[model samples]
Target: MSDAAGTDATVEISTDGACLGNPGVGGWGAVLRYRGKEKRISGAETETTNNRMELTAAIEALALLTRPSNVVIWTDSSYVKDGITKWVAGWQRNGWKTAAKKPVKNDDLWQRLLDEEKRHTVQWRWVKGHNGDHYNEIADDLATSAARNLRDAP
Candidate 1:
């Protein structure tokens, strides 16, 4: 865990999600930064969707932050980023239903993300995938590794 950039002691997280098929093996990866150093965390599910993996990556990353701090999160999933930063308030006002009057998907993970979000001041940024960003590439690699592991695991 070496400091790649010279930033203050704040948490910077980058997450990526991968799925073999729409409802097939999937995985998520997150790179957590603190004091210029990084910790990589990832997991996989045998049967899941890309959206779930995306939300799971963010959820897992936020869970790693033990204390409230100025946090920056970079994600490739618009759903995860937009859902929290934009749509969450309206959803809450509407009793967790979408604008189309449909129940929100992944309510559990969304609740966890919202809870963790309340505990910290987070800045969400959407990054384009496969754009040669170092942290984003690392997260993508970790996610693909997790998906491969899931497929090979007994």
Candidate 2:
């Protein structure tokens, strides 16, 4: 959406992930805010890791943008924040291997994140989890609720 200034609105987003077990039912959630308008979205996967879900939340939210945008994403997962901001470039340069020469885990989501990131000017900020930050808490609730529902599904 464009602002009154005729420029693309900056989007503010908060994302989170949850799992019933480390590699069990996993869910991801994202809340996107643009020009005072907000959207909340969440999803689940039967077998996945929390880190993958976190990455998925960010990827899914950013994917909703139809054009390049200025976006800021707040996340509780250091894996998501640091992976994208601190580690991805090196990972790419090393052919998705870590400095220890080990293959990067969740390289698939990392690749997808990198692609989505290219379409926006994004700033990733890490927020401490369970700290009563409104947006983070909402995202966490959404993720946990989704995971719990999926886990309880018959």
Top TM-score hit: 2
lDDT of 1 by residue, 21-46 (tens): 87899999999987657799999999
Q: Which whole-number lDDT from 0 to 100 does residue 140 have in model 2?
A: 92
lDDT of each: 0.87, 0.90
**Lowest summed lDDT over 10 consecutive residues: which window, candidate 1?**
1-10
For model 1, the superposed segments whose C-alpha errors exceed 4 Å read 1-8
TM-score of decoy 2: 0.94
Candidate 2: the clashing residue pairs are none
Assess candidate 2 and give its lDDT: 0.90
| Candidate 2 segments exceeding 4 Å error | 1-8
Cα lDDT of model 2 by residue, 1-154, tens digit: 3231236668899999998899999999999899889899999999999999999999999898777888899999999999998999999999999999999999999999989989888899999999999999999989999999888889
